[model samples]
Target: MGDYLVRAIGYNGQVRAFATRTTETVGEAQRRHNTWPVVSAALGRSMTAAVMMGAMLKGEDKLTVKIEGNGPIGPMIIDADAKGDVRGYVTNGQVHFDLNEYGKLDVRAGVGTEGFMTVVKDLGLRDMFSGQTPIVSGEIAEDFTYYFATSEQVPSSVGLGVLVNPDNSILAAGGFILQIMPGCEEETIESIEKHLSTIEPVSKMIEKGMTPEQILEAVLGEEGNVQILSTMPIRFQCQCSKERFGAAILGLGVKEIQDMIEEQGEIETQCHFCLQTYDFSEAELQGLIDEINA
Candidate 1:
């Protein structure tokens, strides 16, 4: 249907896996950001992986994925929570390049290899968890695989893909994460590796209308080894609003509001994630100032 993900255990709990279809979600991002082909692919791939990582969290937990590479596309930031809500934006959305030798969008050329992928997890604890790893591959998927192995000590296989149309809209976007649990048998690893080597690209599978369950089946085999745990609906959702922004404005104190009223007469704020603009008139600013005085 729209956009959703599936979580499952394969090989009798030896491996935990996730798969998601994010065509619509990425399409929304493309429209919002007006990203060129390569930029769209990079942002979509990061969003796809971040949402699956989000699913790994529990209640009220959230995470931010940042890719700061020394490339034309600049930095990309994605925010996702345990409830399947996600939103992101790239610093430079209008970047594209010729296809690579593989005849795929040159995401690596646009994203650059000399940078870091940082993940910050807000687990509702006093101390948040943060991990940083080098961007081994600007292709996005392999970079995350490396992050899990080197930073988190989890051996994981990540497959992320995004296809863009001639009109620059998203054609297909999806991904899968397969993590080897502790005590996984060598035979199970070999079987999983075999399937991984032969399976179609995730974007092709999504273009073929494969559901997340089917993707997991393709990755983990079809011998009923994959036991689905649950499914979660996902979408590009931004947690920004006028009231929230107004509260933030109020936090700037009465003097700041007065300065804004004197300088601009009205205040306009734009959300970096969704590009939604919010305006506060002089009267509204005065009211906030009065509240601050009160």
Candidate 2:
């Protein structure tokens, strides 16, 4: 099935749950950024979690997740919105290393532990909501779990995993988040911890053809209560274009555009998001100047 996420509530609102299959989403990002095995694991895990987090919002609200780890992979960035739109890139996409002793992708080596993950949320307000925390674990799922429990003060369990192929491509990618709401019972909390301790890694479950619903079931158990909220598609969609680049030049003011016109007769800007280049011809630059002065 095409990649998508399922949002649900469990135990009659005592918990909020999210699960997603991000293979295709991560695949698209791999193609766009040309990421290798280690970087793919890091980026895929972040994207999977970001998609689930995006599903937590309402219309026109969005968020950005940034991991500035001091590892070979450089920075890992992800963006997501309530409409299921998401995109991201890694600065050094070709980073790779030997698998960890657990025979898994060395995401820790790719995304070192000496950095931070910061989230910027746009809730359609004058000022965006943001949170930042140090990278407690280079393994993204734990870091995000820490982010929620500490930064947001919400008890959460994050299971994010990405299996990489021998040829440095994504094999499987997915994750889930189970959050405890206010007034949760002590028994409910113990049940969740027990399930997490025994449950398989989220990526392994995805490879076994588990749907988002099934993933949630794995976490909540057959006897557990789950209320489906909504489902949404997920993919790599970059909202970058030449027109947006032109507007950026306008923001630079008339003199900057004029300097470009005089120096090179034209200018080209490349988007870091999609790596797509935008060129403004001399005439276009002149028009931008006119618009700026107007």
How much lDDT does candidate 2 score?
0.89
The TM-score of candidate 1 is 0.97
TM-score of every candidate: 0.97, 0.97
Clashes of 1: 0
lDDT of each: 0.95, 0.89
The lDDT of model 1 is 0.95
User: How much is 19 displaced in model 2, in angstroms?
Assistant: 0.3
Candidate 1 lDDT trough over 10 residues, lowest sum: 219-228
Regions of candidate 1 where Cα sits further than 4 Å from its true position = none
lDDT of 2 by residue, 151-252 (tens): 899999999988877676778999999999999999888888888899998889999999999989989886558888888888888899888888888899
